[model samples]
Target: MKRKLWLGAGLSAAASALAGIAAYAAHRLSGPTAALKRETLFAFTPFETGVDWEEVRFNSVDGLQIRAWWLGRPESKRVVIGCHGHRGRKDELLGIGSGLWRAGMNVLIFDFRGRGESDDSICSLAYHEVGDLHGAIKYVEARLPEAQIGVIGYSMGAAVSLLGSADQPAVKAVVADSSFAEMANLVDFALANRRLPPRPLRALADQITAQRYGYRFEAVRPIEALIRYGQRPLLVIHCTGDTVIPVVDAYDLYAAAQGPKELWIVEDMPHCGAYFADRPAYVKRVAEFFERYL
Candidate 1:
């Protein structure tokens, strides 16, 4: 009986330790990390590309300040919002902004909360970032009431734009690149990459995440958001070589879109590498998409 009691105690302690470790990992994954906060030059910029731009700032619904660059004059009614990927800054979208600027479209590229010059806060991936994107749209609407707005987003930003624009009539079109279908899939992917089993740990992490962050992982489904996004033309782009987000997500998004939609599956490129794969073609295709839909 003594030996059995000791074994039970040891097993309980081990289970507690595992749960604690999972909670810590979940917190780190869902919050801002150094990589997500780091300022890195991963893409060509509007400055280098020679486009007219003005620095701007706006506030999220939760009162977090967001910094952005307006890449064209207010004279044009066509506007596109550029949303960068996870671990990315607004500078990374400047190239795309510059392209759209030349296409006679106003572009707004902003940093999500806890990134670039924005206020420091936890990143709930696409969950909290939806407010930030909505803030950008409000800023643009106030600046140009007659504006026809579209969105171009990469990875997490892609997810954010989809979620933010679902009920927003102001946004008319969306180009989502390398976006995940579900938040749970993302968590599972991370777990699989680490060679960890995703069963109980994933559920435990989700519970801990909701308790700590005030948002459930299941609430961040862009696939479901697309279903609610009515009549907005969608262009779902993903690379075949994207390991971060499966190409099947593109198919799911395309199927979920309620309006006119198009899918572009690029050949053998990494995550969000469609732009770098063929700059001119990518810009032309995306600009034409906004022109047609927006």
Candidate 2:
């Protein structure tokens, strides 16, 4: 009887420990992330790319202030919005924005809330950030009533673009680079990679995350969002060497998409490494995609 009691106690304690660890991980995942140093990562701006830009600010649906840069004029009628990835700032997208601007499209790059120059908020891992992207679309529509908008996003931004613009008719095309298909699968993969117990922990972490942030990990499914695109064009870009998000996700997204879609899988590049691999090719492909579709 004593040994049974001792074993029961040990099992209870172990379960409690696992639950605690899962809770901690959940908070860390949904918590505010430290912003990267913009100047260090991006040495140049729109000026260096020979485009004139304006500093702009808008508010998200939830009333969070969003800071952005508008490159090129509304007269272009075609606009491309650049969405940066996790912990990254608008500065990181200047290169892509400059390319789009040179391609004769107005470009808008903004910092997601809780990242840089935006209102501080809990990072719901692109769930709530969808509102931020919508705010950007509204800003574009207001600036250029005849604007045909396209979106190019990397990693989390890619996921946001998929979710945020699914029902938005203003966005004509999307280029999703290194986006995850589902948040739950991503959490499972992340926990497993860290050598943590994934079964119970995954569900528990999601529960805690939802309790804390009012959003569930399982609810953000970019794969399902693709079905809503209908006849709109989508370009899924991923690298075989991407470790942050499996290249399989790109394939999944492409398969799930119902409309006119294209998938480009590059070799020997990490997450979002395709741009750095060959800037000119990357720019040309994206610019041509927008020109053809938007």
- Model number with the top TM-score: 2
TM-score of each: 0.92, 0.93
Q: What is the alpha-carbon lDDT of model 2 when measured against the actual structure?
A: 0.88
Q: In lDDT terms, which candidate is top?
A: 2
Model 1 spans > 4 angstroms off = 1-10, 32-35, 39-45
Q: Cα lDDT of all candidates, in order?
A: 0.87, 0.88
lDDT (Cα, tens digit) per residue for candidate 1, span 141-186? 9999999999999999999989999989999999999999998988
Tens-digit per-residue lDDT, 1-294, candidate 2: 999999999999999998998888777667744433233343455677778898899999889999898997646788999999977888889898988888889999999988778878878788988999999999998888889999999999999999998989899999999999998888878888888888899888888888888898877999988877677899999999988899999999999888889999999999999999999999999999999988
